[model samples]
Target: MGVTIAIDCMGGDHGPAVTVPAALSFLRSHADANVILVGREEAIQPLLGTAQSEFGARLKLRPASEVVTMDDPPAIAMRTKKDSSMRVVMDLVKAGEANAAVSAGNTGALMAISRFVLKTLPGVDRPAIATVLPSMRGHTYVLDLGANVDCSAEHLLQFGVMGSSLVAAIEHKERPSVGLLNIGEEAIKGNDVVKEAADLLRASGLNFYGNVEGDDIYEGTVDVVVCDGFVGNVALKTSEGLAQMLGAMLKEEFSRSLLTKLMAAVALPVLKRFKQRVDHRLYNGAPLLGLRGVVLKSHGSADVLAFSTALARAAEAASNRLIERISERMASMNEVKA
Candidate 1:
């Protein structure tokens, strides 16, 4: 059987409207893939419509009575929303009914519920959110994206190891180089925690490239960039805001006058290509790395294409045995220390 993915159909801002279509698109692209749509039957069924016949056995619906809202507190959602679509999707993974789970839900709630249900991998102190970001050299994998705001030097080391394994497994890169995200590239430039983390990473048997400044992330100085959640989240949000602002400014410039409009018409193709290269939708899925089972968090405002991209990522992670690879890597690291 192909990899089965459980999708939280009622989780995102757009809810079923975005998810159902995305699931359908995913099924169409991935011939061997199957999806278990987890949400209220009434809410999801209408969206599926007659397409169910087309997908047939490849698509199935699993009803979930409760829905977790974006505003729900992590603790409250974990405690009271046991039957929520997000939790149900994770439950399917735990039950071996699905290889992975995808949700465009509240990030805090998703992380809390996933940790509670799937637990952390062996030797993993905490789970980190890792995502692919556009870089000038190509792309780079960055981790600890808003998962654990307060992380220690040890945690940063673990993030490097986990991020390395993730890139190795998914990108098929051997010994992918890892860089420590810091204020400066010099060894003594950062604070005590970052300095300590850099030392640990260098000795941790990973392909550590020492400290990297903020610009190094887009320069693709390393295959993986590791940092505490606070720094990582700030970097991610800043990049997102910059992308949006640039796009808006470009649109305004293109519409300024007849001359600019003509120039835009001539450059339309190039602009389209550039947009495709940096489109956040193409990289919407951020895996909650270190979890025992595969779980991906899609952007809350994701549309069909973005949600479908997340589903594709979850399937790839499952097929590649990403969790198992991380576990084995951690075990080997422990053995080396011993």
Candidate 2:
């Protein structure tokens, strides 16, 4: 049997335009995978086109009466919009009808609905939005990207353990290095929260690499970077802004002179390759770790390729037994305490 993923068709800014074609493209790429598109039937059916006839059986639809807007408060949506697309998709994952659910919806709503629907693992205090940061050497997993803005030391430690487990499972690292995202490398550089978490992480006996500075994220010094949502969000946005600025600057440089344009012709391939390596959308999806089931949050502005990338990630997360690895790690931690 193939991997099954639940996709929220009405979640992004582009809505079905991005989601439907993305699903079809994924189906084209991975013949064994099944995509369950969740949204209004009328909105999604036409996107499938004539391919709908052959793939209709493989592509299932689960109707969602409403959509949670990007501006909607997460608490209110979770409480009131019980039949929303985010809710329905998460429900499918909780019930095991789907192996994973991917959405480009509001980050807050996605996190809240996922937590409310799937619940956290036994030992986990919260579910975090962990994202993968592409580095010069490889990718590093960063957690609490915007889930809980105010987190405790215990919460940070939990993020460390979860991130470590995830990176290990996905990257096949026997013991992935875990780093506390801090202001500086020294243990005393951060406030009380980071200091305490670093202590706890060291005590937990995992491969703690001490504190890693913000600049270290792209250097790929550690396999997992742990921080609270507030800090992680700032870092994520800053990096994204820088990427955009660099692209714009390169465009200006290429347009300046005829000689530069000739140079641009020679450099276009190299620049395109570098952009692909650093593109956030290329590495857009990451598991909402600590949930009982897999859930991937794609970029809100995700195009067709980004959507297809997320689909592949969802399939990999399921096939690799990510949840099982997390459970095993939790069990090991519990056994040590006992």
Note the residue pairs that clash in candidate 1: none
Report the Cα lDDT for residue 33, model 1: 98
lDDT (CA) per prediction: 0.93, 0.88
Clashes of 2: 0
Q: Model 2, 1-338: lDDT tens per residue?
A: 88899999999889999999999888888889898899988898788787668786778889999989999999998999988888999999988889999999998889888988988888898888888988878998898898889999989988988898888767888799999998854555889988889898998878999999898899999999999999999999998898889889989989899999999999989988987777777787868999898999999889989888988888888878888888788778878888
Q: Write the per-residue lDDT of candidate 1 for residues 1-338, one digit (tens) a residue.
A: 89999999998889999999999999999999999999999999988878789989989999999999989999999999999999999999999999999999999999999999999998899999999998888789999998988888989999998999889878889899999988854565888998899889989999999988889989999999999888999999999999899999999999999999999999999999999988899999999999999999999999999999999999998999899889988999899888
Best by TM-score: 1
User: Candidate 2: lDDT over CA atoms?
Assistant: 0.88
Number of backbone collisions per candidate, in order? 0, 0
Lowest-scoring 10 consecutive residues by lDDT in candidate 2? 181-190
| lDDT value for model 1 | 0.93
